[model samples]
Target: MGGNELPLQRIEPVSVSGRGLPRWLRRTSGPVALVLLWHILSVTGVLPSEVLAGPSTVLSSAATLIETGELQEAMWVSLSRALTGLAIGGSIGVTLAVIAGLFRLGEDLVDATMQMMRTVPNVALIPLLIIWFGIGEAPKIALIALGTAFPLYLNVYAGIRNVDQSLIEVGRTLGLSRLAMIVNVVLPGALPSALVGLRYSLGIAWLALVFGEQINATAGIGYLMANAREFFQTDVIVVCLVVYALLGLGVDFTVRTLEKVFLSWRPAFNGT
Candidate 1:
């Protein structure tokens, strides 16, 4: 190469197969295919409208519900119940986890009891809840709280226990106080596991909401579905089911966003 001339760099062709499709298209293809098949079956009478509504019918019903504002009202009520229950359950779970994780005495007192309680199905407590709190909102919210608490407790406790011993030693060498060490090193280290617990708790919160609303609920998506069932409005029922799915998806996305933000310090694997 001449002193005044730039070296010719090797130019490689970009791989078309990997880059051709947009990520959104690739992600949506499976659901789109399933929907198309559903539409075809609905039109061909292999799937009856009475038994299950097609995607188009469901969409139209959702639109109608939106225009009427009933869907929005029901959604707000349902969302409130789910969030309230989550807050109560999550607070209790974290508090218990922290106490038990930090002290041997606390663990002895709390962990075994929690383990025993966790095995009992939340649904089995519904009758007792109804008797204790009556057929009102209390029973429903309590059911949700009971359902969400255990998964969070287990995960957070495990996370705290799993914190690296070397990091604890480093804190000791730095002469960090117990509170400071926990705040700066331990909590941060345990955050990824806490977030995992949060995701699982959020999913259970929705499921609990479903069963909770079944107990003489006058409002919410479950009520809407129950009413639709009486009239055989399969389209409306499908719309409610879709709404539940979309809400769960939205919350999961929120958690993933949180992981990106809070857990950014840690390295993670992204599949090829």
Candidate 2:
């Protein structure tokens, strides 16, 4: 090869199979394969229906529930509980985080107490909650709120603390007021970590809801599962489980979308 000319190099052709498929389909391939395997096991009697229903049966049961409007009502109740809990818990967490993160006195008063409380398992409080609030919606919502609060509190506090001191210096140099510095510089810097906390809290909220609803729930996915358990309706149970999983996934996706929108200016490393 001439010094001035680039040397000829071999280039590998892209695989036709991979290139032909959509990205979404490729991402879902593992789940699809698992479903296929599940179907095979179910049909071959390797996996008993009593233990776990096949996907088809689960789908059929879900459709019937939807048709009868049972699933819709359950979903609405469950979602309302989860969202209400999240709102209440999120408010408390953020408020405490702000106080503890920004002021030494606040930290002294709040952080230690929160740290102590966080160590106690939220589920372990179920009995106390039931006694305090009864088996109605209050205990369940409170459980979810308690489960969610700590994660957000921890993450937001850490995020606020870990913010680059240089940025604070810049804000000071620019003569930004305390409130302005927090609103503009501190909050923006802490957002990514807060979003991570939100994702975690969202997952925990679902788990909490699951456990909470088991407390003599009259309506909700947990109630459906409980009712199904009595009748050995494996398919309905599976459907409820799937719904819980999907709801968690949906909230996580929503947070991710929010992160992308809010943190668009920040550069991140995409995997090779």
Which candidate wins on lDDT? 2
Per-residue lDDT of model 2, residues 5-105, tens digit only: 87778776454334566889888999889999999999999999989999899999999999999999999899999999999999999899989999999
Which RMSD does model 1 reach against the true structure? 2.7
- State which candidate has the highest TM-score: 1
The TM-score of candidate 1 is 0.94
lDDT, residue 10, candidate 2: 73
> Pairs clashing in candidate 1?
none
lDDT of 1 by residue, 85-179 (tens): 98999999989999999899999999999999999999999999999999999999998898888888999999999999999999999999999
TM-score (C-alpha, index-matched) for candidate 2: 0.92
